[model samples]
Target: MGLLIIRLITFLNSQAPETTNYHIAMTMLANYSNLHLISIGKIAKLCNVSKSTISKFARQLGFDDYLDLKDNAAFIENRFNNPLNYLSNILTSIETDGFDNYLNAVTTDINFLRVNLDFDAVDNIAKAINDYDNVAAFGLVFSESAAIDMQYKLAYNGKFIRTFQDDVIQEDFLRNAGEDTLIIILTNSGDYLTKQQIKLGTPRKDIFSKTKAKIVVISSNPVVKNFSFVDEALIFPHQTKYQTHSIMYQIITDLIVSRYRYFNSLL
Candidate 1:
């Protein structure tokens, strides 16, 4: 569970608000958690109250001020597995201030990418792709588009990249995929198909465990790294509730393509 979810759950479990201010505060946090972010004015507007009302609401929630609550919420949300939610929070935060806030958010995201990226893992993925005779990419509902995007980008470089949506096609590819084959999976929720081969679904866990080909997972959840069958795992920055996964997917795909180009240049 992401920190935003946890905070929301915690707030929900709290006793019913005794005052209007407290109620407003609870609502702000609740809505913010679901939406992934909000500003004081927005919260006030949504609650049909004055900005001061929202500020009082924050203090009632044990925050020193409104900004303190927002910052804390953003920090907690960033630690979770939901990159989309985390990104939403960052975007919301950006909207609250001027250009400086936007720049800070971008810088934060870039720093996060630098800190968490595993170059060795990326190198392994590049090598697998270079050596593979065939490559297939798979993603769940939210990730399917991203998978296709990656396929198109990789194909432009004269590589055979197949994108799979169903289990029948995936299994067919997996069965045919050898030691020199690579399977790239994209999932932010960390859940993928894992059922009968004919069903167009295969449990992500099973795919990792059973496939003989090299596997690379671009996931929001850290559990992807726990699978021994996975050859490499790349974790994108977590997003807040209001944000979408499209930006993160674009960033990850671009990084992979850049790496591929650099590796090819050396060859």
Candidate 2:
């Protein structure tokens, strides 16, 4: 789910049932498809509240204004409507393939990665971690989790890596980043540069352009290498739709840290 939907759900959970704000949030979620078109006056009428109350409710949910809320609602609408981005796509794959067959396919993909992964690139990234004092990793959803994993693991070796769950906060970090910092972007597919949206539900225009940090992308999509800001790209084999990059990312993180420690031991 996108940020707006998640915020609405959180609001619903914390609220008592059948209240004004609760009713408004519920209405917004129930009519998620047309949320962008639902004007503040209309929602206020539907929830039997004043327009000012609706505006306050929007702010309570962390939106700058009613229009900002609508923009984010539109983004949520587009994201859930797309079958390719839906979480249930994995469930459908599991049902069709059966559990055993799905496991076998994942095993095969793991073995393929084992045989095909570029050790030189992995070692180079490990070295980069040692060479740079400031490093950060970023991605969307599962990719974001991988970034957190990288940060946690690297800390054991006296290296600190930055990561953020909020797109706005991540953008703020990138805005001030300089050549002294290294950025590692983890993407299951190479589409993050094009598809990522900020808190305002708008494309991050010139976000990378503003940063002078050295960038390295680890992804299953080879096309990430073509991006002008990227200094290095580590491409892994793409697995089936049922499988996510979680396992592969963990393996990559472990290998990089192992190599980092090996090199550090020599000192």
Candidate 3:
């Protein structure tokens, strides 16, 4: 809402620059909450804009002054911040013998899944798997096992599932892969190797551009914003250092496979 409001105002005013102050202001506001607060001039300086502009920006957003912006931004920041509400307790548990606190962390992640996982998305991916002529599963080292396991399991249950572990093999296959292919990718982070570094344009983006395959991406990375090419995405909890997140990935894999199996059985 804030971003849109600021952007809308910027657009209406038309007095803004090529790249509006939205990103600049948002970056500063993202860090400076009420508790760990800084001065308005400091924020303006950090954003590389004038104090008057900052005040005007705040006033445009209906805040009385910069202080009000800070207070409101603090609330917004806290609201959208990490949902580890039980972290303090979890830490206390670690130092002492607080087992329930530890348990709470697991349950918190479970709750995150409970809220985030859309069964309809799962069903959609499953239907695609059943409908597609070729189902290729991709995952790297940690998830390679899951992909291979899924391939074997689906094949056993009378589904021809393909696993692609090698990037060269994936690129080669994708070069020829088509709309009839359903590509399910399992990654702890949604960032694909295909989207990473390479010398040429064709080498970097070609893998995706060449394929007309429907994509299913299951990932735990919070930073992954959009899967524009993906038909269905089953996102699990954000990564945490305390817990073994591979278990979360594995659980998601199990659910998807189970759902796929059930749907397959129906057919």
Candidate 4:
């Protein structure tokens, strides 16, 4: 991987890709792909380029598609997963501006969610979670904790929510799922890579293939347009070195539960 990255850097220095955004995107891919899990859409948004332009940049790098580039990035990310190192990195950010910056960052993100998120779309997603015969939250590590949080919050309301961490258990949940099941998946990318090193989805296939389980994805990264088979995706802002994805996921979970209760009150 080091050799490949060195060669990639050399190529970027020499060839000078189509646009400045390409250069920025490739440089990020070369250095921090492992540390920061980002989607093409996030890079595009960060670079102020179109998604197609990002795809074009990947092709310039010899990948077959943008997803391939992202998968390669995930493969690289797999090696750098570290708990204490990550925690230290996040801590360093606190020194930059202290509690005020911390509070502002989180508040800004929540306001961004309130302004940009579609409540009707959220209502549709909440309705699915509320109306489903069975609901399962699937993820690993930090993401798994978010799933557990969702279950604990809703189970008090009499929702039969199941949360899974073990692969064996998740497979059982999926195999038995059907039109009645709603699966909430947590990950930066649907590729399901994480610091815990657990891969939940099958290679080259979306999870939940065996049944008609409705999928609601609350992603830590940018979700590209028209993600097939996914009924809903609530995207979190791209994590800076210090940011946490679960913060945004928690906000969404709160809104979903609150929305559910609000509607039930009308009944």
Candidate 5:
């Protein structure tokens, strides 16, 4: 899920279905394929509201203006190939290859991780979480779910961590972080470093450059190793066709937090 869509969906979920904000958000989602074509005037007319109403709706969703909202939408449009499309691909595979075959592929990925994952690097990350007073984990959509899971699991082990759902705030935190901060990027495909951009027009590389925090990128994408900004890159197994599912992130999070618990004598 792109951050823009996530915000829109969140807005829709919070508002009543008959509200103008809900109608506008539902319209934007339904016409997401042509989000660039959306304008305040058009949405206002469609929803039987004034242009000011649409602009207010945009601000309520955290955009400075309607144009800013559209710009973010365009950014998401370019960054993501639509995760739902990837889900459809998985569904097609299950239909064609059988559910048992799909499960076997998932098992193969789990087995590969169990065999190939570097326990030393896992311990190092866990140690960093213990050493640093401020730690934040970030990822997109499904990967973000893993970060939240990590936050919860670590809480039980007496390690409180932070996770951000909004990319704008996530970047703000990065830009202002101190040297004592430990930034963990939990990306399944590593697209955040290579392709993602902040709403302020800064690329991920630029944001990393501005941050003094130690950066660790845990990804299945091997290409992250080429990035100099990453202080440590824990590259996970990437041979599976189920990259869209992001199951590895949860597994890796469990491993890291479990190790953190072990180091604290709670395991």
Candidate 6:
């Protein structure tokens, strides 16, 4: 975690002098976990700067852009309440202990999941699906289970949905996706298959480009905002470092499924 903090500090230091608002940005980054639901525009405004300036600040930090910086900050902030002191604890835990370290990690993971529960996101997801005809769910590894779970729930409600786990299969599905298909992606890192799609550089941004079929991303990493193709994003907090299971993802999926089911009943 010292490495993470050092990397973050180095990135902040690299920002342009004119765009340097390191103090305010650091304050915001430090408090990011508490302000999980806050909008980027709001953060910029709070920093007394334009959104583009904030973006530049993020770029200076060696991030691909503002969203990347925000996401990374949020991930690090979520790991510990006190960003400054958390690094020492993290490193110490790594050296002196095993079972105690495991327990702390589990506790952190559970807390992260418990803290992030946004009803507004669930409502938006349900509304988006209600307006679309077909839904395509995509993810890899842990997220694969999330995508499949979403597909199952949607299918049970009589919605046309497909789940894609393999990158090749996912790309093919996206390429052939209809105009009325919504792409739902579940990822914690947001670096796996989705990054591959971006690398492909398809003119078919239209796959996630349409208003009719919008893209909704659920990720712990804030990098979801980097996808111009994505229309909406829901960020989950990164749970403990040790536990592989994602309770927040499961809960968010459940909320989305329940919302869609209820909406369908009304129709």
- List candidate 2 stretches off by more than 4 Å: 6-64, 74-88, 197-205, 239-241
Off by over 4 Å in 6: 1-107, 197-213, 243-245
For each predicted model, how many residue pairs clash, with residues at least 3 apart or on different chains?
20, 0, 0, 0, 0, 2
lDDT of each: 0.64, 0.79, 0.62, 0.64, 0.77, 0.63
Candidate 6 C-alpha lDDT tens digits along 1-267: 222244445446545645447655675656666544556688777877788887776664455766665554434432433332333445555666766776777667767666765678878888888878777888754576778777787778778777754444665677777667888877666654234422212223333443444678887778777777777888766555543345556777778888988887887
Tens digit per residue, CA lDDT, model 4, 1-267: 222243245346555478675466575654554413677777777667788987776676555766765565543332444432334445666776686776777777777777887677668767887777678887755677788898988877767688854544566676678877888887755555222233213345344455578877777565522566677877766424445666877878888888877765665
Over the full model, what C-alpha lDDT does candidate 6 score relative to the true structure? Answer: 0.63
Off by over 4 Å in 5: 1-3, 10-39, 45-50, 59-64, 67-85, 197-205
Q: What RMSD, rounded to one decimal, does every model reach?
A: 15.8, 4.9, 16.1, 16.3, 4.0, 16.5
For model 4, the stretches where C-alpha displacement exceeds 4 angstroms are 1-85, 95-102, 193-206, 222-225, 239-241
Candidate 2 per-residue lDDT over residues 127-235, each given as its tens digit: 8877888999998777887898988998888878888765666778888999999999888766666665435434445777668999888998888788898888888
- By TM-score, is 2 or 5 better? 5
Cα lDDT for residue 30, candidate 2 = 82
Per-prediction TM-score to the true structure, in the order listed: 0.53, 0.76, 0.54, 0.58, 0.79, 0.53
- Model 5 Cα lDDT, one tens digit per residue, 160-254: 99987766667789899999999999876666776563344434557876789999989877888787888877878655565534677778888
Q: TM-score for model 2?
A: 0.76
Which order, best to worst by TM-score?
5, 2, 4, 3, 1, 6
Q: Which ten residues in a row have the lowest lDDT in candidate 6?
A: 197-206
What lDDT score goes with residue 238 in model 4?
Answer: 45
lDDT of 3 at 76: 44
Least lDDT summed over 10 consecutive residues: which range in candidate 4? 193-202
